[model samples]
Target: MKNLLIKLLHHNTRILQILLFFDLVILALHLTFGSTTPFFHLDFEQNLSTFYQSSKLIGFGMIFFLLGLSRQVKLEMKSFILPLALGLIFLGVDEWFQIHENIYRVFELFEWLRPSKVVEASMSMGYHSSLWILYYIPLFLIFAVWSGYWLRYFQSKLKTNVWVIIFSGLCFLTVLLMEILSSTGSYSGATYYWLVTVEELAEMLLASMLVFIGSKILSK
Candidate 1:
């Protein structure tokens, strides 16, 4: 167990450093501002927002890192790298600016720009239009373009890519499940706090995982 721990630490030293940096920042914020102050607030500069922003930034970095690696290896599927990087760049910007939410607001302002009557009626039937149009559609398009390239990359190097896949899955689960639950007010009191903590921690973990993946690619 001790040997395994030592090897794991040695292998993931960069990830550990990134995680430790965020941990200390969060800890310092909580200690200075009071315990509940950092957790319950939804301010733009709050801990939760910072975590979200950091995760997006890390994701942006990871895409470019992968692009560089693909170039270095002279990979055949290098054509997709620029698009993937651009998509991640947009994601990072959207994360910080809430661009999708702004799109919804813009549609709301111009009635003619809103969805059709059928779509609006469906939305009234507990169907979230934003879920379909705002998030799912864009993600589906991006994934559709990238999935085959990613599959080929993973097939060629399963062990190294597995960590990236796992962390990406975690980020997806946290955003799709935990964030949705929090938005829906599905938990209260302590449960809500715990949910928020888990969601933010997942974001942090995802960022760390991206750093680890970048390190792995660079090492190779």
Candidate 2:
């Protein structure tokens, strides 16, 4: 038991540092560009959508990389391509959903769907405002692939332990707490609740699995 514990400690120190660094970057980004200043002004709707859409997508990428890092299954182009397409589809769907009930935003393409004469006569501003995010799809895809590559590269470089697990749990819990707080109020005309409890549960399970596997492999 003594040797085992010591081994765990030694192995996890480096991995823990890496995790901490990654977390710092995540927090810093949110603070710097996530709708508003971190603690002082929390815009629920704006920040919630921002965090959920961006972080969850990034997390999806991380999961991809972690699964690849495991090396239990072979990697294939089709595997990544399908999920990437699915991710973009989900993003597009979510963007469409945002337009619902928000009078400030409009469905820009409906004008085009109508006859050109009707559009010329109508006073509607036929511009799709939310489509700007579509430009980010490629960047997000690259980030996800990079995450997987990094995991595989670092597979043999770090160590993990119970402390590391605790740290990871805290990271996941912080995200959940932030989401809860962000979802509690209204911002930019959208209100929501914990609608997908099952999905959240699955995320927690996957996160735990990542920590467990990382610890097992890195432990001396």
Assess every candidate by TM-score.
0.62, 0.29
Q: Write the per-residue lDDT of candidate 2 for residues 71-157, one digit (tens) a residue.
A: 443455335434543543444344335432242234344654333434343326542222322333465467457546644555454
lDDT of each: 0.54, 0.41
Q: What is the lDDT of residue 21 in candidate 2?
A: 57
Predicted candidate 1 versus true structure: per-residue lDDT over 8-109, tens digit per residue = 434555665666587556644644563457452433343465655546564646545455454353455344444555555665666566675555555555
Top lDDT prediction, candidate number = 1
RMSD of each: 7.2, 13.3
Clashes of each: 0, 5
Model 2 worst lDDT run, 10 consecutive residues: 190-199
Q: Which residue segments of model 2 deviate by more than 4 Å? A: 1-16, 29-160, 186-220
Candidate 1 wrong stretches, greater than 4 Å: 1-17, 20-77, 106-136, 144-148, 160-164
